[model samples]
Target: MIISRACPTCRSSLKLTQKDLFDDRYGSPGKHSVFSCPKCGFGKTIPGLNRQNIGKFYARYYPLSNENPKEM
Candidate 1:
């Protein structure tokens, strides 16, 4: 099935390029999809995370400590 959405950048028709993508780095649950805008070549992720979820994901996987950034 081909799914389409409006591009967040240019408001163009975004085509579904990839689906069921998983977050292997953080082992986050749920599947995500990628959409690409043919006009602007911009890409976006479907089912974008809310503010709360974004904070959680960053805190769990990406810490802002002064430690070696490359190690992370």
Candidate 2:
């Protein structure tokens, strides 16, 4: 049962699940995995990276990744 939603930035249909990030270095069973919108190639890493930090990844890890800003 994947929760599907439209990308807020690209408006592409997003159906996210654990299987989508099988070999990811950033996500895990505990962390949330954010997949990309195939149309726009918008790769987002859904946060909650830290146990103590929640609902604040935008200010927390979003900028530190140093990856493509649009993708982050």
Candidate 3:
């Protein structure tokens, strides 16, 4: 069941929508459902994602950068 989230910006009701599951912009893998406030038009990633898997996913899928080779 989809649950509505409260907008942090305006305290309005937010609705979940299908969004790109993986976000690799930061060189870390992320899986999230998109939530946007209908009233204020605010948007953000849904909360309560599995925190435990973040480290593992990042370690495995984070992109390599020559600028910070130590991170690899």
Candidate 4:
């Protein structure tokens, strides 16, 4: 399914440019898309992280001092 969003800057509809983009560095769990507003040239990730997911992503995937950062 194609998902579109409104650009925060121009209030224009953002089109999906890239789909199923994954976080290769952190390996966070989620398939995201890149959306670009044709009017404002603004870009954003579809289904952006909220307070809940932000914390979870950091806690689960983000490496701490004790963990090896290059292991991923």
Ten residues in sequence with the least summed lDDT for candidate 2? 23-32
What is candidate 3's CA lDDT for residue 67?
A: 48
Report the Cα lDDT for residue 15, model 2: 52
Index of the highest-lDDT prediction: 4
On lDDT, the stronger of 3 and 4 is 4
| Model 2: CA > 4 A from native | 1-4, 17-29, 46-72
Using TM-score as the yardstick, the better of models 2 and 3 is 3
TM-score, prediction 4: 0.65
lDDT at position 38, candidate 1:
93
TM for every model, in the order presented, reads: 0.70, 0.37, 0.49, 0.65
Please report the TM-score between candidate 1 and the true structure.
Answer: 0.70
lDDT of 2 by residue, 1-72 (tens): 344466768898865544335435433234347766778776665542455554354544345555665686
lDDT (10s digit) by residue, model 4, range 7-71: 99989999989999998988877788899989989999877777767866777887575755568
**Candidate 1 — what's its lDDT?**
0.80
Q: What is the C-alpha lDDT of each candidate?
A: 0.80, 0.55, 0.69, 0.81
Residue-level lDDT for 29 in candidate 1: 79
**1-72 in candidate 1: lDDT tens per residue?**
343488878899888899999989777778889989999999888767677788768777777676664697
Ordering by lDDT: 4, 1, 3, 2
Task: Write out the backbone clash pairs for model 2.
Answer: none
